[model samples]
Target: MRDFTWHVFTQTGDIEAYLLYKEMHNLGAPELGANAGAEDDEGNVADEE
Candidate 1:
């Protein structure tokens, strides 16, 4: 989705597409951040059983 939005933004210079790409990038940033750690759905580390 981000790639598509970015492609559209580049091709047409649509401000909305650029904004959408920026918004999606910002929204996904935290999930990949440091505090996320190596945890699972139950908040358990991957190697701890």
Candidate 2:
């Protein structure tokens, strides 16, 4: 589901729908980690640059 939503977002550039899908599934903000500041669902810190 996450993959599909991300694919949709990539193909259509619809961030709103992608976020809605993530919210529906209680998904963490993985995309936020692109900046090296977001955490995972388990609260583990991701590697920072």
Query: Whole-model Cα lDDT per candidate?
Result: 0.73, 0.62
- Superposition TM-score, candidate 2 onto the true structure: 0.38
Any runs in candidate 2 off by more than 4 Å, and if so which?
21-49
Positional deviation of residue 6's Cα in model 1 after best superposition, in angstroms: 0.1
Compose the digit string of candidate 2's lDDT tens values, residues 1-49: 4555677888899988688767956856444334333335335534341
How close is every model to the real structure, measured as TM-score?
0.57, 0.38
Candidate closest to the true structure, highest TM-score: 1
lDDT (tens digit, per residue) of candidate 1 on 1-49: 6777788999999999999989999888332433443454456645567
